[model samples]
Target: MTTTADPPQPDDAGAPETDPPAPPAGAEDPATSFTRQRATRWLEPHLLLRMSLRAVVSAILGEYNDKRELMGEIEADGFLDLSTPDGDLWIDYVADLGDGFAATYAVATLLSRPELEVAPQGGTTHSTRQGRLLVLGGDECYPAAHVDEYENRLVGPYRAALPRKDPDAPCLQAVPGNHDWYDGLTAFMRTFCQGRWIGGWRSRQARSYFATKLSAGWWLWGVDIQFDTYLDEAQLSYFRRIAEELRPGDAVLLCTGKPSWVAATDDDVEAYATLDFFEREVIHPRHARVRLALTGDRHHYSRYGASDGAQKITAGGGGAFLSATHHLPETIHVPPPRSRARSKSRSTTYQRCDVYPEAGDSRRLSRGILRLPFATPTFAALLGGVYALLTLAVGAALRDPAHGLVEDVHAMAAALRGADVGRLAGGLADSVAAFLLCAVVIGGAVAFTRDASRRRGRITGLVHGLLHLTLLIVVIRGATWLTAGMPGTWSLALVVPLVFAVGGILAAELVALYLLVVDRLFGINSNELFAGQAIPDRRNFLRLRLQPDGTLTVYPIGVRRVPRDWDLRPGWVPGDRERFAPVDGIVAPFLIEEPIPIPRTAPGTAA
Candidate 1:
């Protein structure tokens, strides 16, 4: 494979002085429009609650009544042909981006630079030029895809990174993740599929899904699985037409929103089944090989490679919260050895290789869950309210009609001073409504457990609920003893406030502990544990180069920590490249692991 030299361009040269024609109204704004801001706080109680509700709505209504079906009607075909003057190609692959301004801008600034000096592991440092084509695998915006959010979190930072139009500007294409679909892909289509310019990079795709002919004998297929729903007739038909152009021995790079291969290993087979069917029925028949697959829903970097040299990589670490990599399976059989899904594709074993942040760092970071009370005070406050409600319920359920607050407190204390705690619990069970409420609390905890359909998942949830329930009992009894000694109604005023403030912290801490325990013991709640942490470190992205001889070299670049401060560059324009520069100096990105080289030829096939 022969590499071509792309001479670096000077900062002041190559870019046009004026902006690309004004974007459509409500479209993405250029970088200079907004100031850089902090990353999203995923664990904020309000955000978590809102996102949970949005997810439920999306699952029930969004997936079934897909927006993609309607998009097919407006767009003629989902294809972007970029195959031109035969030569080497450089491409940038990033996913799970568009969170905080600093993290997103950091990656974008690096991408915008003419070339980077990357330090590959155990090898001499080398310089690699920026990609001419930028592929956003999925989840372009965090939380939800809305017009304003696109401008703030995503568009503004990216435009700032590469502000002006340059002669060698890259082209941008994207696939929607579940987050983007939360808004029914309205903002996503406006941002990427409208054939507008995103910063200096051109948006050429006309539909949510696109088949890009990168060059002769090489193709890049960006498919929209839309919440892992089956490929609609329109999407299937579009790809089928693209397949018609494939010649024998052609190579393909698949870009999808989710990592179906990883999902299949966890017994969620629907996504993997659909992907497999597409390969067997639509691609394999044409004798075109899917040499590589990329996805970004996980917010981490992981590669699963088969003996045949096909790689399925998850590199979602563009700018979102850092996801844990410790729980990834060491090996998985694609489609599972024994599944009911119909498929002719042979079962291939993919072994996990090169996980970023290393498993140890992931575990160390999980400890951050313990800081939940301070990090997410909103969630902590909610927990406090729940505790207060439980306390009121217990007091009401045990209240004697003839007794007042002070009298009732003293009476209950005296009556239960020597009585067994079980007897008190049994008395609460006497109130069917009260018991049901308690049961609901337990069930709610269990519901948060992943794979709730499985016994282990249910048990983990039960344990989580029981811990909270036990805390409630202790707080109630402890307050009874302490306040029984205090005189009058004053105790009531003091206790009520404490229940909301102090109790909240206790409940939140209990949840954090539960998450840490379950993640280590059962490999559950890893996402929740880290989402609570909202870590902004360990960011990464992939830069790929396709040589003239048809071989691909992947540089997995990473930043150990993102810079938090930035200074405005001198004489920067609204759409110029150097709008914001890191005040502490640019943090160099290093290769997380050794570079992976994949020849157009497979291990057992002839070139």
Candidate 2:
């Protein structure tokens, strides 16, 4: 287990290395250990209300999907040229974006922060600011990538949060994530491909991918990969034109919606292979090298590299649930340095931030649990065990011994003591039937809670049912053995059966609780089949500056030691759209900037 600490800096920049023999993989990164100190909160009853009005609007826009001709021809007029007034290109990159209002609202606040805002603010010593190009990594909205969802979840919140750029309006561009393709890129194109007004910003790109020209031999090459399933002859041809435009020794900054080959646990090959294909098929053919590659998905800050000094970063912290910093495969993980709070917002309870997920819910639940530091299962199981014991003691006193049910229990005691196995079955019928009650309790708990805008609830009734049966068996055998001393009739029915039944239920809950806690530490399974890592609760972004001669300096900004901006008003409609402000309060206090040095290589146009 690697504890979260200051990230390492290469002593001197050199060529990126080939995949080296990795250290043994282990669970629990530093962030996981730090989160253990989190305090318990009696959560306010969460009551999520359906936004019928938003639904009505979405229904109206559904017809637009058929009008591809009107949204305009699939534009691939590749690349936009903006002047480098200061000889530096600044772009703010965020991905896994488009949660509800609060989520986008928070990011907009970062964009609108006084420090980032163009106008000079008083009392600020440093004059560093935000980017001219706003690039989205992917996954623009949640549930399913419908047009209506984009309006309320993405366009509306961002519009309300950021003031529009004009004349020299900062350019906005995006590549779709898996969720965006859920609708076959229908909504994604309309919102982003149109290159007009979207959430008060102007889209400048013509296609899902772009080859932008930056100054001094630096270029930005972003591609769609189209879910890694849609790349075609036309896409390859588009890059061929880009390659023709490039000079020898020119370096490229690559952007994709997904991160692959960065971790040992990453089993997906589409994106990873797409990258390889691009490098061999397009980049190498042009004699250009990918200097830096950035991606979203896996919502945290992580960096890895190849044998040629090239680097890849996973900076999906835009506004999704924080991923488990602890669970990152030990292979290429980089921890960030701890920071002192300049000023912070009043701490609020931890709130789940993931609304748009690329995979199944069971995986979502597992990942969400992993992001939290607390070993909730141990404590939760303790509580369940106490409740089990108490339920037995209290339930016994409430029952009248003369009742037939109670009397049968008394007979059950006699058989149990006498080893009268045949008689015991008949006496225990009611108690055995009552075991279903344990399943019922577990099923109900699983059904009631959920996250917003995700494709499905993390926990489900059926999932709990299976879990109940498995845990019940353990309880039954354990309870049977523990109560070996049923010496009398009174002990078997009134005392023993009650204790055994309640104890068994509570014991089952304890086991379930353990699964929930461990899921965060070592995210394995989900409530749903085919789940992936538990989603994390971090909100971060990357700032990259392309140096004149192709060397790139990267500053990865992290939000805080522990997130406290989890306060959201009731209702799916974030009515407080006007209230979204800089995260955790104060200017630039929460962001930790760790500069990575890129090796300066000889500059020339490759033949």
Candidate 3:
């Protein structure tokens, strides 16, 4: 093998210097920079070898698995035109997917319609044939920003959508979600820059939360509530500045990842803690002429009112995991002079607002009305009833052979034989006991069926069902033991009860398993499965039963398949239908001008 000689080094004289003076032996080479050293250390043989092997394997196998993803800056081309013919703006609140994968999906959906227009509500608002879209929250990749991850997860999907850039297309504004700061915003800055390096501005790498003037008078402010913590001094000052800049008729849209109030169960402490923080730090200040405060991360849709006359809208339903059904509390603040209170629940929906320069009638202008469904309580009750009945039936069938139906019959026959007077007397008592036991079973079944028909939730139905099943098993076993011929020893008497207990346990287990499957895999509550068919097409209306207090107690109607045009008047007493809102414009509040008696029957008129 032949080796090439090293290149000659030039000295101060511009000639090759032989035997140049050597520096301190321990000193590092002056040619090596800190960056080079750091890079070398990071890419040491052990680390590089491991990463390289994994990468090669992934490449060969066509698998690009990595937790950290870098969704590159979404180019202007990937967005669809949402500008209305008259040019109304389309604002989308999206969040919770790391690496921008989910955000890209939501953006694509909005862009799919090209006929949409973008218009400004405040200032010299103009309507564009192109639809303008604004992203409310969650624009960063999750966990950490790895360049390759962003490319594959975020950029790839966005490119696939091929968003268009309309000369009048709505401007895009974004707020940083919690994941953006995982690695100190390094990846976010690089990816959002679109291959251009952004210089440091105000100690932030140009990409940290900034506002853009979308329209002449409307200022859209995006705030980054870093790591779920309260706004820092810098961020608070920034918001104040933005607020001060707002004009009287201007619309201010504040965007964040977390909602001010979350719907949660009584047992969930974490959610309540968050709610407390939001109330004190954010909602209390009543800052800005907030047209809308949009948020995500709850994976549901909800709208609440702020004291500032702003609507706090949660738009977290962007095709991620659905959240729990939320129920609004009685104490929840409702806007004064409202005809009806709004329900609080996590819903999957997108909102459209039509704001016209406060022209003519303010009400007619339709200020940011949200069109979404409230999860009906009727459905919950129906599910509860169905699950209870099915589980009870299954439990009965699985009863141990030794203690169930067969044993009861055998004991009854023994008592009737009258072979021995003492035995006959004992058998007679046993027979009566058995009869009462069966009655208990019957009672349980009746309670369960009645509660279920009334459409109680799973918790109530479950209690009734389990009680009935247990009572039924116990009664059957007791009858069997009483009717059987007297055993000489106590040990033999124990057998019958043991058999019954074993059978009952088995039945209970099966019922529990069935319920688990219904809840987890199918998202069906057991009550609904066993309950009778749900009321059809009346999702928006709550079926109320009259109470002594002269108030209406609303019940949910679970059925979605019922025709919207169907009349419930046949079931309603005469004149009851007149009290309800007319079918057209049913969204208006029900005005009770006088005391109207509750209709005993369903409404005869079509709703």
Candidate 4:
């Protein structure tokens, strides 16, 4: 009986006699479940409110000129490198016109390399040793029709990097961007047209929109997309006539500022849809050798194809401010389709494509080789990180030994002692002055940090601003210390407090700005105001709502009126009643109880 009882007593190594009860379905442990639900409920509305406020602030402050000084400095330094391995082929320049206005310009002789060869589909590659290079795109600067501006911004760069044009090279052909129409293509036609001279007459110059054939068998058709609208009746007729005249082996290279089906505004998209008209009426009917379209307004490179085998290539980043980031569509149609393989930075690099004839196959497609400097966001982030780390390390290493870290502390104390003091009262006054100076330095730093975090649009901007503000405070404090003439040596105690005070002031200012401008004006309700998480959409309209049950609902406002064409839509409206689960997982009504006021003050107004 004793042995049996001992055996029945549970042994440490044996399995438990009974298993713990399983958690109920859709339920978690009390501590963990409560924490998760709390987090989700708190974060959802807060983020939305914060983003709405940021957008409103950006819209209001966008017109301010707070960075005029910075702009001037950038302009003076010419903030870009325009050199190539071959030599300086382009002069990139930025001009500050004062009051926050600036213009960027670049010039380069973009000549096709004669020695380069292009291989056609189904044919052996052949070299074009000395063929004339044609200017496939820009021949003149637009909008700023002033001869001086054009000469400085456009002609100068090309002349500086002027490639030796082969005497027997083909005459350059050209297309015009939106800017060309600002002056009605007058200057462009005067510079490039070889036929009837248009002279100073605007109407005659505008006639440059007319089409002309560059070679006998190969037709270079120029189409003027006015405001990125569809081709006019005359242009369409001209294209049709040219299509009819094209022989079986002849190729038509179409030039325009805007590609036929690339992303653009509704009006522009509608206009380019007319390319379909061309494809059905002319391209497919003729079944020509090669139908190539080239454009440059995007300021980036891309290749697309129409269903009828029409190839479209965008070579817009020709020494201009690079286009915004682009994403390739899922269903792009090209003869030999290519997809975007990598992400890239906003760059000013230019691309050069070399085309050559293949030896064996006459029915082969043309080969294109693109040359441009590659860039990536990762590279930029790495460079910025290195710079920041180096700065911090250098600053830390350069501290004064007497003060434990700060070199100027002792000198500052000494300066305070040397101040002219006729009596005990005067000496006290000098001491007080020294203390106030320290306070100012501290206050400035706090203000800077607070402002910086609130204005966190770009990481680089935040880092640069914080570093600069801190340095300013440091220099000011050091100068004040030197002038005061006191007797005490530098001490870590004093230095630490001073640095802390400065940082605190900066942070406070930023917080204050966020609360006053961002939160109040933009209706940002975060955990600070309402105990919940926040969600924000930077590109949409503002929206925020506090719920009856203590939770807040925040999102973009004005949904019904949001154009169907818009890529994104804000979630809320004034009268509509709907419920939405915010990013933080809090569910609340979509519409807010009250309307938020939009400030008329421009962006950077506070700055």
- lDDT string for model 1 (135-182, tens) is 999999887888788778887888777767655568888889999988
Q: Evaluated with TM-score, which candidate comes out highest?
A: 1
Give the range where candidate 3 is weakest over 10 consecutive residues by summed lDDT: 196-205
CA shift of 151, model 4, Å: 2.1
lDDT of 1 at 250: 83
User: Which stretches in model 1 have alpha-carbon errors above 4 Å?
Assistant: 1-32, 35-38, 84-86, 403-433, 480-484, 570-576, 583-586
lDDT of 4 by residue, 143-229 (tens): 233444454444333322222222222333346555444444444544443221111101111233433332323444556665454
| For every candidate, C-alpha RMSD to the true structure in Å | 5.9, 16.7, 23.5, 31.6
In model 3, what lDDT does residue 198 have?
10
Per-residue lDDT over 1-607 for candidate 3, one digit per residue giving the tens place of the 0 to 100 score: 1111111221211322332232222132211211110001111225435544644553433223221122212111111122233323333334543332333333333333343222222323222121234353663443234565544544433333332222233433346655455444545555543211111000111234545443323444555655454455555444444444444444445566665333222212233233234333443344323345566654334444433334555554332232322222222322122212232222212222211111122222111111100122232233333333332233233323346565643443333222343432232224444334434444543443322224433444455445544543344344345645654233224433443444444433333443334334433332322111111111111112223222222221111121222122233332121111123222211111111122211233111
lDDT for model 1 comes to 0.77
List, residue by residue over 9-77, the lDDT tens digit for candidate 2: 121222122222222222212111111112111111110112233344444443343222232234333
Pick out the ten consecutive residues of candidate 1 with the lowest summed lDDT: 1-10
Give the C-alpha miss distance for residue 164 in model 2, angstroms: 3.2
Predicted structure 3: lDDT:
0.34
Using all chains and alpha carbons, the TM-scores for the candidates as numbered come to 0.90, 0.58, 0.36, 0.35
Best candidate according to lDDT: 1
Candidate structures ordered by TM-score, highest first: 1, 2, 3, 4
Clashes of each: 4, 26, 54, 54
Q: Is candidate 1 or 4 superior in lDDT? A: 1
- Sorted by lDDT, highest first, which candidate order results? 1, 2, 3, 4
